[model samples]
Target chain A: MWYVKNALTRKNLMALTGLFLSFFLIIHLFGNLQLLLPEAEAKLQYNWYSDLLADNILIKIIAMVLYLCIILHTLDAIYLTVKSKKAKGSGYVKDRRGRASKWYSRNMMFLGSIVFLFLVIHFKDFWYQFKFGELPLDANGNKDLYTLVIKAFDQLWYVIVYIIAIIALGYHLLHGVFSAHRTLGLYHPLYSKIVKYLGMAYTIIMTIGYIIIPIFIYLNR
Target chain B: MKIHLKIWRQKDSQSKGEFKDYTLDDVHQELSFLEMLDTLNLKLVKKGEYPVEFDHDCREGICGQCGMMINGIAHGPLKNTTTCQLHMRSFKDGDTIYIEPFKAAAFPVVRDLKVNRSSLDHIITSGGYVSVDTGQAPEANSIPIAHEEAEAAFDAAACIGCGACVASCKNASAALFTSAKITQLELLPQGQTETSKRVISMVKQMEEEGFGHCTNTEACQVECPEDISVLNIARMNYEYNKAKILNK
Candidate 1:
């Protein structure tokens, strides 16, 4: 009840869930980087990695936490968004308030909605197919998720969707990462500056890393 | 110089507001923004028209009483300056300035260019002060505060409560104002006695006042007349988390 009632507590939940999701991006990118390998070795290695994650108890637990984080993050965002709409009493004529802050910083909710929509499409294409949809096995006898991923990216339109979604995610991280630190009370000036730059660098790397895969697969195919 | 004004006019909070147009010729560039408004009001009075109603006191920036959206910015285009301190020189001749009261659900317009800002006072009353005895003034040297701590406290204390932060914020969040109030006291030795209780009660009151949650867009810091750092918000979050966790 305290967490639900307190605005700061709700923000804390948002920050915690957002940071966790950010951390997950690094791991997700690393695993998916296997897709960059030569097709002969990539299929076997990627399938083995997927199978490893599917069978591991710890990965399963982490996956569950990841799912929960996504749900909670989305729900909190919706709650906060509705509250904010009511709080902003009226519209301004000849408005120029955008001069003060960065456009992405003010529009995080919009960027996040794009990312959320992409995730629904992303999970359906890869996660659902791997988990429940029947798929041909690879040389390693694991579900050929590598081939599935390749097939999706091989299409130009699908690749375009992936690129747009990743860019949206990049802008979301551009603000969300630094903002979460502030919300979590990282008040020291020096450490806050460090985190700010680190967030920027991390966002850039993750964006490029994720975007490169789809392009690489599409081009190579 | 000549200028065109589109100022918001509303009879009361219950009535619909609209932007009414007026033109002023022979305006002096050296006049303060409010002084220019005063000149405009004088002209209207001579014509038997109700002059535009705006809030101001002391005619100085410190009172925080003079606040409005000038060209869609809280206190005009000048950063870290109040409406009363802004001079007509900032605008070009024939510039069309749009003036509107600070808009927020918590701050209803009482009339043209004047909103009920008592919601801000409510946040302060919720516990923006220390609990001290009323007997006598304490010895000046009783508490030896570090210079850095004193300076930081002063910086936080500089908040003029102009409501500009809320006006500029897309969420209309009062985080900067509330946090500055909390941090100014939280930094000193005297305010430590009720730190936990003060933060909890004040934050609870802010929520009750219908302010949106802070998303850390940092617009508040940009528009703050005192240049209050967003770091104060981070400090407030820290103090709030500590209080909630320690449960003291």
Candidate 2:
């Protein structure tokens, strides 16, 4: 009774970070949707959208906040992971049997790492390109950010990599979303199942949405 | 299945213990882990040796009375299951196992694989309940406890106070057990009138009992035989925060 914290706080932390990331994904989805448009509509002219976002002081502040959230979530997850491992040490010689948790839940750390790697790739290509890349003028004489997107997505290997990352992201979110809600005090038994199923659906939709983008571009090209 | 056991054996409360070796033969693959120990005990009795003494009752796994360090795991290497429910088939032949009782400053080893869990009882007595009179039954449907709330409270109440949550924790914290009791009583109409006082007093008692802060590691749930949701802890936090801030 003197030392161990209960299993509940870990669940809450996971839930809060997960919900925050879900919100981020919505904004991210909207920003990426522009790439799905036809070449003309999505061309270097679209680069102005990026410039506008960059120029807005409020948006800048929000972005900073988003960055902080991401960092906090990652660190918290790491800490929980370590503590969970130590708690598990007490049971080192348990008769190897009955692991009741879903596989995705147990492997969340691995899946999350994959998603993190994907984010790095995504930032390098899109975020870095929009902000720092030297762009050639398009037919409309606007910065050719759209052309860059199309060209990157046109590569078969890049599309394949994106598809894999999106699949992993789906797995991570599938378990994470509902788990977070439970941690954040959504323990009502009546709606818990509903929440879990909806969380799964949400994970599927987001993963599929991201996965479809690269394939659509590659196939159309 | 065969297992190599490294068990800690102590004569009494004042005695320091050491590991004892055991070999169990023809272990039924389907027997619960506790049942396997039962088999070993039978053998020890037949051999005119002192049988291992451990705490157990309601072997259905809800009572939380049976717990030991099996193979270094709190309830053997199972997630969301009690020691009594852990089947021997989970292991293979020729396996070596280590068993010991729960160890903590507050939990003194009473015998071979039985530690005193009275600290938990004290925490409960300090304030795990409401002050409702024990005379007559109230109209059940009149109080209007939503179905969801009732079920949620029941789930938390499923905790048998086995102390597995504490034994499984790195810091030996009883937050899960404490939270479950707090949530169970705090959910009903009879309990609601005194929710603030109940939680404050219970948590204060919990701290006085020397339990550590919650760090969010989920090992207790993983090893809990009852699969009691760790979510009750969040509710505990919500209540504690509200009570502390509002000074209720």
Candidate 3:
């Protein structure tokens, strides 16, 4: 069936995976907020949360699904880019971009790549370290994932990288949140307006939440 | 009014094209956009130069034949106005107008401002109609439809296939055009039998024609001469999803 082969299917794949990852961000952000508690409480609570997540079979399954979503989303983006370039045939000789779309909307791939690269670095530093690298135990015997994160955010370059990444994520979501609904067929005008406003608020809140953690950690240190 | 024109000129589909400049000094503000071009062409003919080529059939905007990007905006600067409907008053004295063919892989340049929009026809060919025997035309009120539903269907039916939507889209996507057709048929009682089949094939054809995927930038709707809503695209996606799940 051309269902699998059609552009619409590919777009639906993008929207589905993108929205799933957006959900994951909410969960990820809520957990990371534990990093902002008072020093003693932050250490124990963050590590305990990390240990809980790492140990649970259900969370592990969800993590696996998250990884698959990332891979599929990235690959589909590449495929769509190539196909679109082909569809464009020849690039416009005189481009007038600002008249047509939001700057972030037109540059989604570039912003997404920045976020993807940051994700790789993020996972390598935090997730890989907590899972496989040597770690000290807190007094409660939980892995000292909190200290690892604090130490990582302590470095100026690390914090700057994070701020940049968070900004990229913000712009990515600016286009993505409403775009996902559009792709999935949210057509009503009034509802679309509501969704658009809600999307902006969500992107702002989520990005600021993620942004504050790194800056808060860096400044407090 | 005086105007400077940078019009794309090409020999044919295979030849390279470039913008050629001309100055029109004796132009009036009352002429339609196409009429101004006609004046320019007449001037070119007296000089033994080939007049610029463009597509037009019914100058009244319903035919969907006339379109070109005027100064980077499809169907010119006026919103929801076709090229024929756009008046020269939109321009001022000494205006520099840049005209180019609709840029899309599927719409290769035929010559000058005219590009082959047959890709759109191919999508329509794939499945844009209902199948019925031609014994006799059915009575208008034989199958009752709600007023709003019929109006919604008619709104979609207003698409003239001008390819301005394609021209205006950054991705060169034809989602609005294709969706308008699908919604037109899918909303009616007579179209119910082939609704599932029509969406699948037409969507497939649209993709195969090398149009890019729609990211819903909303540019197409803004630039569409008929004011065809981008909501039609959402309806199309819903119809395609419904067809995929239920048709099987």
Candidate 4:
């Protein structure tokens, strides 16, 4: 209860949930990478992997946790944003405060809203279809989620949206990853510097990795 | 040299405020920013008009009493310099300068270019000091503090409580100011007696003062006159979190 009311405690929750979500992105990317294989093999392998995750008890629990993290992260952000708006007394007549920080660092909520919108479309298309909608079976008797993925990305506009969303995600992580560490109290200068660079590297890799999947699929199709 | 000014003018806290333009002729390039304002005030008073009100003391950067948004940047465009220390040479003769008070919900405007910063003092009063027995002065080496630790503490202690961090922050957060005070005491042996209590109360008091949460934009350190590090914020988080876990 005290944690709920405290600012730092709320930030701690934000950091923990954010880091967990960041970790989940790595696993999600690797699993989805199977879509890059030769078409026939790709369909079977990707579908099989999807089926494997669906049937596993641990993956189901993790999925629930992932949903919870998303909700908490979003709600906390909304609360913090409202509090900040109230704290800012009035608008400046001739403001130029932007020079002090990066554009993306200051516009995190805007970037996050983009990513959040993409998540809705993403879940409705892939996640909902795989879980609740009817899908034809593949050669391996697995639900044909891979074909769904390929068909989705094959559309030029869909691929463009995917790339745009992934880019937004990259910018979000650029600030979020290291910011989470600082919120959790990683105070040493050497280690903090290391984390800062490591965050940049991770953000770059994740962005490239996610962006290439949609582009590669759209082009190769 | 001639200078153009668009300064905020308000009769008092209850009244609405707005920018009023004025021009000063024969302005010296070497005048401090405050002195330039003084000249404007002199002109206004000679005509039996109310001089524009602002805050300043010591005329040096050390007191931290003088601060304003010079062209929207707290403490002016110069890095690591205060309002009083900033000379008019930084600006061009024909340029227009906009001077505004430090604006925040916690810092209510008392008049033109002056806001009540007592909210900062409230945070300090909550737990910014140590409780020691009244007695003869202790020996210098009695505590045996490490040289590096003393220096680090001194770095945090260099904060003059100017409220530039609050003015510069997009969220109007006082994390840098509050954390600097917390870190200065938390680092030394003398401050050990109430480490857990000190962090919790100061942080609580900070939130109670209606300041926003720090999003770690690092602007506070950028605008801070002392170049106070954002790492102090991390340290404050470290202390606050540690106390929460241990105390509970």
Candidate 5:
């Protein structure tokens, strides 16, 4: 049965879901970067962009598909965590923590779960509010989602939580991106160094870029 | 240098085990770890106690029999080296070494440091063989496999089923050990006929034998003694996925 695969085989599921969601993260991060423009420019630009995405029949369907990817990614990660623990058994396996693995690599599930919780909070605050909550009118009398983002991020706790979430997200992405490359046959020995360095740089840039928006909003307020 | 040894002593599969310690004197720091154990056993026999029961053959380190946890780490702390090849110079003077057997569900301790590696043998026996019948040895360059494939296959074939992979694993998974044999056979032209069936049977047998799944920890690779890449594991997954998809 298909359920047997979902239930019994956790590792392949992890790799498949991990790789897919990694691609999803890249696209989502790229879209969110539109918010980085100056206030007047980004508000008009990003809000129109957001409205176009929400209004498009094709994009709405794709957004639903992206939601499915995130759900499957979470489920697969949970399944793999349970199975690996069962396999290793409930015994002291001498914190093989230091030498052979990165801290983020070993703690990926925990980091991922933090990111997952952040996503829920994020979707509630911004994604759902932008889509469904009543918004104050902009200068053009359009629903003002960009202003909403800037206003909400003005809270110190919101900015702190957002930064922590992005840091966790970055750590998760850092290990997953390189590890998935290795898993799915990225084996050119010379280019391997280039790929790893690129992965690290990608993680750092994405985290900092994402972090700066909330900080800028808070400080500007 | 003088050293104290606490070695696992179990008479047979039926007997319970305990840590039995004995001090060794006038030991050379240049001796290999196994050679030091050999010296301790020699002293025990002279004093009319049972020689410490451990496994070693081909003390040059090719055979996988010489492995025992030198302290807590499998095959000791050295990377990509077997117990027999690990020299005493790695240890400081007057070190108290606690040696124990490789522990796992499938690999039951038969006596001291030797377990029933027949589980690995069973896994290999399940599908580790090629179906080639009796024939003249093929001449060199007859098959003309790509040079990279041949070298990769050679690397996979280099696995000695030493169980360092299992011992080093958090889950004691045998994916590395099993995949090496699977990859070695799958790479050759002679193994092409049964390649589909071989991977399926070997993987099923591996799972059935109560071995756990690989997490790709690379701990096994670090402790492998042969430095078997985790790449072989990815190759195994790729092959298994292909076989299942094509045949299903």
Candidate 6:
């Protein structure tokens, strides 16, 4: 309640939700990495893993939380963007952006929108198909999510979309990960440095892992 | 050395502003940035033209009065240098320098390069002081403070309320400025008495002033004349979040 009304509190909300999503990226990347195993083995392993996640009560709870994090993060971004625009007043007659910070840092809202569009397409294609759309069962009787993924990746345009989305995700994470820590008040210089490096590592690894999955699948197919 | 300047000229807050170009061939590299502006103003005055108006006080960097965006930087190209402290020597002959006011919704242009920064004062009034009985001065060593803590508090106390942090921030956020006061007081035993109330009121006043949220891009710290740490912002958030959850 306090968060929705106050700008500072709302920012705290954005940071909290944004960090949660960042954490989710690591977990999601780990699970999806299973897609890189030997073809037949990967198909069985990924499907079993996917089904295990789908059937687990804990995963369901986490899924709900993830959905909430996404919604809150988007809404908070919109609120902060509107506030920032109004507070900016008239445009500067001479603009020199990125003199200090990165370009992505200033255009977080724009990057977030691209990532949001990707999420919508991503969820509709995989999550929706697995849950509601007709999906064949694998040898282990799990939803044939692996086949669906390969089919999606087989298309050059779909693979390109995933690559573009992942690139945007990389830029978003570049600023978001460390910014979230600062938002949560990580002030100590040494610890802040450690967190900064850790954040960069996470962003690099997650983006690479996600990018590799689709490309590997598309190529092998 | 001759210097070309593109300066923003605004008549008033309600009027539209424009950048007017002026070439000064008599500029000396030894003159400070503000002094160079003074020379240009004198020329305009001699010609019966309206002189450019700006704010300045101590000329020394400590006063925190004179600051304007020089080429889109909060206090010009030199890092951690205030406008009054910047010498024309930092520039080269025939370089086109752009001078403008620190732009923010809260910092409306008063005239030429001067902007109203009273919003910062209102935030301080909300909760920037310690209130105790004024009967007598406390004993010098009454409350012992750690040496590191004292030093840290002093560092936070160095903020000059110059609007550079807001001007440099991408979102025009005043988190750095507001946080400096919060960190300064929150570290002291005397400050702990009203820490909860002070942070709550100050942060609320900051938002009411129409400043944007802090995205922690850290451009403010890069452009801050005092070299104020962005960590101060984290400290402020810590105090505010603590007050919101625990104070209730």
Using Cα atoms, each model's DockQ against the true complex is 0.84, 0.10, 0.67, 0.81, 0.22, 0.76
Show the lowest summed lDDT stretch of 10 residues, model 2 chain B. Answer: B208-217
Error of 1 at A177 (Å): 0.6
Best candidate, DockQ-wise?
1
User: What's chain A's TM-score in each predicted model?
Assistant: 0.97, 0.85, 0.97, 0.98, 0.87, 0.97
Q: Which parts of model 5 are misplaced by more than 4 Å?
A: A5-10, A89-97, A131-134, A140-142, A185-198, B4-26, B41-52, B135-149
In order, what lDDT does every prediction score?
A: 0.93, 0.74, 0.90, 0.93, 0.76, 0.91
lDDT tens readout by residue for model 6, A35-112 = 999999999999999999999999999999999999989998888898999998885766664698888988899999
Superposed Cα deviation of residue B71, candidate 2 (Å): 8.4
Per-model tally of clashing residue pairs: 0, 27, 0, 0, 0, 0
Instruction: Give the distance in Å from residue A100's predicted Cα in candidate 2 to where it truly belongs.
Output: 1.0
Write the number of the candidate with greater DockQ, choosing between 1 and 5. 1
List model 2 lDDT by residue over B132-227, tens digit each. Answer: 678898776777879888997898888888887777665566878988998888887778878778777777776666555454456678877777
- Residue by residue across B29-123, what tens digits does model 6's lDDT show? 99999999999999999999999999999999998899998988888989988999999999999999989899999999999999999999999
Per-residue alpha-carbon lDDT of model 2 for A1-221, expressed as tens digits? 11334334444555676788787887877777777778667764467666667789999988887777667677666766665454333333333222434566657788888888888898899888777888786665556677788899989999999988888888888877876765555655567668889888888778888887888889985
Q: lDDT, candidate 4, residue B102?
A: 90
User: Mind giving the per-residue lDDT tens digits that candidate 3 earns over B1-248?
Assistant: 99999998888878888888999998999999999999999999999999988999899888999998888888888889889889999999999999888899999998898899999999999999889998989898889999998999999999999998888777889999999999999889999789889988998999889999998888888888899989999888988888898878
RMSD of each: 1.1, 6.0, 1.8, 1.1, 3.5, 1.5
Tell me the tens digit of each residue's lDDT in model 4 across B69-188: 999999999999999999999999789899999989999999999899999999999999999889987887878889999999999999999999999999899999999999999889
- A66-123: candidate 3 lDDT, tens digit per residue: 9989998998888888878888866555555348568888788999999999999988
**Model 4 RMSD, rounded to 1 decimal:** 1.1
Give per-residue CA lDDT, model 4, range A1-221, as digits (tens). 22486778888988999999999999999998898899888999999999999999999999999999999998888888888998988858877788898878898899999999999999999999999999999988999998899899989999999999999999999999999999999889999999999999999999999999998998897
List the candidate numbers ranked by lDDT, top first. 1, 4, 6, 3, 5, 2
Q: How many backbone clashes does candidate 3 have?
A: 0
